[model samples]
Target: MPPPFPSRAEIEADQLEQLRALVTELFPANAFYTRKLEDCGVTFDVASLADFSRRFPFTTKAELVADQAAHPPFGSNLTYPLAAYTRFHQTSGTTGAPLRWLDTPESWAWLRELWTRVFTAAGVTAADRVCFAFSFGPFLGFWMAFESAQQLGCLCLPTGGMSSAARLRLLLDNGVTTLCCTPTYALRLGEVAREEGLDLGRSRVRRILVAGEPGGSLPAVRARIESLWPDARVRDHHGMTEVGPVTYECPAQPGVLHVMESGHYAEVIAPATGQPVSPGETGELVLTPLGRVASPVLRYRTGDLVRPAAVRAACVCGTHELALAGGILGRTDDMVIVRGVNVHPAAVEEILRAAGGVAEYQVTVTTRGPLAELALAIEPAADAGDATALARKIGGALETALGLRIPVHTVAAGSLPRFELKARRWHRAGK
Candidate 1:
């Protein structure tokens, strides 16, 4: 059985203990954290979470980037010596330069254990044939997931580098009962299955586990994926390379997700001020992955927008771990102010997804003029005709929903590039 989440009181005590231990373990050998903590007048005698938050400075991507640049290859975030480390992984470099992260044998094992719990939360077992449908690379996306699924005693199939059709064939031929991929790739596979005349709805696959994007949490997008595979359920997994698996969509609550409070500490703070938001109010997600001495992120700012879950709400999972209202609303950095009207691409995506005729769409922000402008390009579904009319309708609908006039263009069928990994949905000028 999976490790049950501890209660709030247990989490508070455990987190403080872990925080103290982390400080002791890292401050000795890790120059990066030692300087960071000491500069802020922080010490081992930190009393509460509030004290920890106030005394310790928040870790940002810019600092990590600068640190790595100063120290080539891997940064000096390691508590243990290089000889003590065994694992190597890196970030996707989505925002800027790719951050090269190293882990000690202990920390590597930490990640493996965390992933096992993640898989178990998704209800995977040895009997399930898990097919990894991700494009494997240096990216840490499903690399750990593949390893952890194997740990679950399941038949782990690595379909990396294989074509969509080939992957579909592997899933069907091998009796793959569960799939692990990004939400975009899952939908791409559905499109391929339709094109290849393969009925995915009748396949043996029963669960679709998705990560690396907000699509899984979107009811409209989740519904579309679920519709493609009739009996299959879509589970959303949220985490980052810096932070180990932090949260997973629970089977007990269905759409509601619980954070891995036992493994990591979480806080919801105002994106600009770093102050804790009011209960149930939206804020940026600040994470602290405990026990990762080799590459520990102390009160790291994740830039992910989220809301704190209420206490004693809905069906309790027997473990009263902190729950998230809607998993990852959007990224604080990704939110754009379009002509005085603030907009998140995800908000637009939600509207487009609900509109129903879009097969695939991309949002482009043009900074060519004094005022920032937004445009939408979409490929209409096969059955949907009158592309011009559809685009016009979508444009009008976006105007109504966003309270701003935005231009919408129709792209020819199969013109828009499809993504196998994280979808690059935004195209900006003068970056």
Candidate 2:
């Protein structure tokens, strides 16, 4: 059985205790955080969460990258000797350079325990068989999730090297009840299933746990995936290799993601001002993982934008944990200015997915012009007829939604790249 949800007061008390313990453990030992905190005039003891937030500086990816470069290999973030760390994984290099993270056995266990909360929220049980449709690379994508699911006594199946068709077969053959993957790959599998005449709607999989992307929370994307697998519930989750598992979608709420306050303390701050945003306002997400002391990050800037809701007087899920209304809205770095308007790739994706008739699409930013322009190359679905007309319709939709005339061109079938992990469809024209 899954663990019961704790009240807001309980969560806050636990956070204070863990934050104090974390600070006590890191001072004078973890070189990276010690220098950072000391330079900011921070002491080993924090009176309150507010005091810690005010005194401690925000840690960024660039700082960590530079530290790793200067120190070589593992950097100075280690709380223990090099030999004390056992697990190794690196970032996906999606934003910039890949960050190498190390974890001791105890810290790794902390990670698995957090993942259990994710599974519990999704209603996954030991009797269910889970299939992870991932590359199983060194990027730390679904490796921890696979292990955590196994620890839950769920029959874990990994389709690391297998093709999409093979993975679909494995899920069906093994009677898998839960499917774990990114929202992008989940759509890819649905596409493949249609191409091969496989009926995924009738499969035994009842839960689709998606992370690494915001599509799972977007209405259009989630609608498309639900249409593909009518019987399964698409659950959105967000995490990072450095920060560990952060938020999971509430089964009771379709689009709301509750921060796993037991695992990490979360704060939303305005990107420009760096001050805490008001409830129901969109801002960047900052996280401080209470556990994982082997390599702790104090108030790490995650770069992902979100809108946080105030604690509910009466909650649907009966948990007072911080809720992000629309999951991850977009990335801070992913915002592009065109014609005096700020646009995110996620916004374009929502428009395209809602427009329909598009199977796969890629965005190319053209910087050679006076103003940066976005050109879209779309691969129409098999059933979408008259590519020329479909392109014009999509172009009008983009203009209507974004108030900018983005050029939409139809690409050959299967010409656009398909992602099995995090999708990098947005590109610069001359890059």
Candidate 3:
């Protein structure tokens, strides 16, 4: 159950108090934020969340990347001395060069506190074996999940660099009940299980928590994953390397995720105007993690599109937590205009997935003179016959669904690249 707060005003008052303390401490200790905040004439003593958000100046990935380059290795985001920093991780660098993140002992422990809340929300217990199928690299993903599972006293099983078949064997042999991996990797594991003649639905696994991508939120993708492991429940978790675990799906509500307000402030703004959007309206998500002072993000533009709920809206789970009704609508920069029709890759995915007969697909946009050309490389499902026929069927469905006729071609199964983490399905042919 959520903390029984009287009203949204109380949440803001508490958050503002916390934010004031954080800024007051950060402005003097953290060079990166100090310079940014001081240059903007933002005082450490803030009166309200509105004043802070409006005056603090938005941080961007580009600025962070440049700072790391100028500072060498780790940037000056640290609020404490170098000796106080113990844990080191980095962003995935999917957008550009990776941003190195250093966490102090206090901040690392802070991450554990957060993951514990989310882990409990996902219904994880000490007796449940949380087998992480992640690569467990320095990307700040599975490392946090693994360490936090230890804090929870759950058996943290690492399956890094192990084949899907081996992972399946390990999970079954150990009677693992909880599984964590990317949504693409989960589906890939299911594919491998089917090819190896294994039954995952009968396995002891009962809950699947997928992050690093938006697949778990897609209706077709979620349905497929749940069908693969019929006894298991699939839920989506949204987090960032720069920002620790921030939002998670409500177990009672399947499509939306409630923003855990314990240590973060979330807002939605129109992408073009940079103005706050009304409740139920779609806009980009901006977050400010009140803790994580060692490497804080102040009103960082997340680039994720969302439809934020009403301030007093409470999910069916009986928690009056803020929720994004549609987990992540799409990326602000991911929209591609084809023949003057704006198309979001996620919406395209929905159409193709619902059409059926596709195991995997990749999207590529090429520059054709003055306009963008969209092309799809589709891999047919195992049970489907005549790959060309499947592609044609999906193409027709997509044209009808997206209201545009784009090219769709069939690719041989096992030919396209497979992803273990966040899948890079969309790519621009030319820079």
Candidate 4:
């Protein structure tokens, strides 16, 4: 039998003991951690959390990439020998090189538990039927999600090779009450449904659990999906292949995502200085997996920008843990500078969707001499006319939303690319 999910306080109290034990186990076994601990001159016997954090050096993707380059495949962070590991997966490599991640049986179970919380938060009960529309590849997309649903006693349906039309038919015919996919895929499915004259609102899917991108937290995106499926509930979740599922959105507070501080230690810090930032201030997200000892990442900088909210005592959700406002704002690398104003692509999408005239849009950024310029190619809605007027409206919205003057251009319908996976909406020239 699996252990029940403990409250935030219970988990935190338990974490102190686990942290000390983990330090002892990883310190001497893993060369990377051993060297990191020795450099800070800290021992596993340290009692204070502050002292422990102060001694350990922050981990970065660049460091991990370098280590992988130094040692092919699994890198040098393994506490157990290569034979001890049981599973292998890699990062999506959307931003850079794919990172190969390994897991022992115990660590894999740990991942199942992390996802279990996500399902529970989304109100996925044993009576529900869940369908995972994923490729089921090595990217850890829906493999764990499927397993976690089985563990939760829900009937799991895997739609890996089926086309979107077939998947839609299966979802309706099988009475799947829950869905798991990227936010982009969910919208894409909506588009397909409209073309097929299928009303998704009449389908059996009552809930949507979205990850893999920032679309879940964006209000316009969320609203658009909800508008299409009026009966379904869409919730945002945050996780990584490197770190297990770490944060989940509380249904009561849809705007914020609560970090599973019991399973991981989260820190918000100044990206350049590596120092802790003040509460409620935007900073880089650093995570340390407490349970994933097989391939543990200590203080791994996730390159996600977030503003940490102070723990509120009187909350509908009983967990007294760190919460990120508006979920993940954007990635540090995804920030676009247009006319000296920093803009997140998600923010731009919100403006376009809100304007109610954009069917699809693409943002292209390039260097013209020394200036960074942004050009938006928008596909107006079927009901929209006067493309230039709509373009000006989009430009005005961007200016008001981000305080940036971005040049918007209207393009022919179907001019922009349609994405089935993660949407590459922004392009940079001469990188």
- Please name the candidate that would achieve the greatest TM-score relative to the true structure: 2
Model 4 lDDT on a 0 to 1 scale: 0.83
Per-residue lDDT tens digits of candidate 1, residues 282-340? 89989999878788998899998887775644336676767777787889988888878
Clashes of each: 0, 0, 0, 0
Q: For each candidate, what TM-score against the reference?
A: 0.95, 0.97, 0.96, 0.94
Candidate 2 lDDT over 353-390, as tens digits, reads 99998999999987765568889999999889999999
The candidate, 2 or 4, that scores higher on TM-score is 2
Which candidate would rank higher by TM-score, 1 or 2? 2
The TM-score of predicted model 4 comes to 0.94
**Candidates arranged by lDDT, highest first:** 2, 3, 1, 4
Better of 2 and 3 by TM-score: 2
Please identify which of the two predictions, 3 or 4, would achieve the higher TM-score against the true structure.
Answer: 3
What would the per-residue lDDT of candidate 3 be over residues 1-431, giving only the tens digit for each residue? 85654356676777888788788888688899889878877777787888876777788788888898888888877788889888888888788787889988888888778878778888998998989998778978788889888898999899998989999989988999999999888889888999999888669988899888777788888888887887998888788888788788887888788777777888789978888999889899888888888888888888988888865555677776688886887889889988888898778877876787778889999976778988999999898799888888988998898788778999888888888988889989865
Best by lDDT: 2
Better of 1 and 2 by lDDT: 2
The alpha-carbon deviation from the true structure for residue 375 of candidate 2, after best TM-score superposition, in angstroms, is 0.7
User: Which regions in candidate 3 have their CA more than 4 angstroms from the true location?
Assistant: 1-7
After TM-score superposition, what is the CA distance of residue 123 in candidate 2 from its true location, in Å?
0.7
Whole-model Cα lDDT of every candidate shown, in order:
0.83, 0.90, 0.84, 0.83
